[model samples]
Target: MTPPVIETRALAIGHGRQPLGRDIAFSLAAGEVLCLLGPNGSGKTTFFRTLLGLLPVLAGEVRVCGEAVAGWSRAAFARQVGYVPQAHAGVFPFTVAEVVLMGRLARIGRFSAPSRQDRDIAADCLDMLGILPLHDRVYTAISGGERQLVLIARALAQQPALLVMDEPTASLDFGNQIRVLDHIGRLRGQGMAVLMSTHQPEHALRVADRIALFNAGQVIADGPPAAMITPARLASLYGVSESAVSASLSPLLSPERNVLP
Candidate 1:
């Protein structure tokens, strides 16, 4: 069998010598969406930083594209893996197209300007995400939802084998959240592996091929959404009762909105 696009084995994640989570073993295969469901301070950010090579691993290993993450340089790593942070205010004077075009840096010839092909790829990514109309707009001037879409477009422009998104939908309104989730759903069909952290169980159910129940820096459970997102599981994950979970999710878990395949 082919190796997973991203794998963490017996890993410990935190900053410096601090270990927030341990025994963090998981693998994400091509054409799969793995959702990490957890609350704030559950060490989700620490875990992502470790996987992205931003923080050192206190123990064990993290591999990306079947190679050790610590050994890959920034340019090579950017080509194989892309990242979308939770929010972006763009803080730069670049336009939307310019921002997306930055994804091509790792692929572009050193010290050379972006090529026509690079621009084409960026434009295609924007079109794919339905944001082509905003190509000329200043990135920082756009609304929060538009900026979120822009960030996703930039990551897609990298043409990566794996995409790691940190709470991509945290600040979006209802409509925008659905848009982001729909785009994520489409990525698996394109054979791109995705690992994302989300607090919304309903969102995880809608888009994840597998859901890992994370709490107190540990993955308490891992499986398909149907099996992992039950009332009892939700209750356990969120420290609530099964009846309350069922009551809150009644509409989402209804006959018409069922996400099980």
Candidate 2:
């Protein structure tokens, strides 16, 4: 049997001396897209960092590609797991192509220069994301949407089996949101296991194969989007009445029975 790309068993994640979320048992297999849906400060970021090995797991285990994450070195782990962070201001003056090429550094020794194939892969990633024209632009000079695309391209250049994205469409306009979601869907079709966090229930409906509903630091529900995102479940997760949820969701999700004239 092919092992999952990432698996957490009885996992507890948070800062040292403080556990934020517990019993977060889940497995993400290749060609899967699992969306973590939660409100702000609900420990979604904490869980994400822990899975990326940036923070310590307070208990339980996280295995990536059949081996314990704790046993893998930074470079070894990065080779198989890539991360796409929320778009942020860049302090450095690195060009877009340069930033994408940085992903290959996991395989390239720190002291070594990027090889021809490394450059090719970077270019390919940019092309794949339809952002090859931004190759020479200063990373900080791009708009938020473009910056997010660049970050996705950078993670793709890593050629990882599993990708973790944090709010990939957070600040984008409506069209950009669809574009980002489309890219995510494309990646899933290409057999990459994706674990991403988002606040938008609609985004989960559009892209997630599975939804993990988070509330008060733990996963309240985990299942296919169709099964997990009922009006009652959403209302419970967000502490609202089911009628309010149905009303808000009806326009984009179904008939307008919940809404009134």
Model 2 is weakest, by summed lDDT over 10 consecutive residues, at: 252-261
In candidate 2, stretches whose alpha carbon ends up further than 4 angstroms from where it belongs are: 255-261
Q: What are the TM-scores, per candidate, against the unseen true structure?
A: 0.95, 0.94
Candidate no. 2 TM-score? 0.94
* Candidate 1 colliding pairs, count: 0
At residue 223, give the lDDT of candidate 2.
96
Candidate 2 RMSD to the real structure: 3.0
RMSD of 1: 1.6
- Candidate of highest TM-score: 1
After TM-score superposition, the amount by which residue 22's alpha carbon in candidate 1 deviates from its true location, in angstroms, is 1.2
**Residue-wise lDDT of candidate 2 within 1-261, one digit each (tens)?**
999999989999878788888888889999999999987789888888999999988999999988898878899998999999887778899999999999999989789999999999999989877789999999999988888888888898899999999998887888778877888898899999999999888888888999999877788889998898889998988888999998888876665442211
Clashes of 2: 0
What lDDT tens digits, residue by residue, belong to model 1 across residues 109-171? Answer: 569899899999999999987889999999989898899888999999999999999999988
Per-candidate RMSD, Å: 1.6, 3.0
Q: After superposition, how far is residue 235 of candidate 2 from its true place, in Å?
A: 0.7
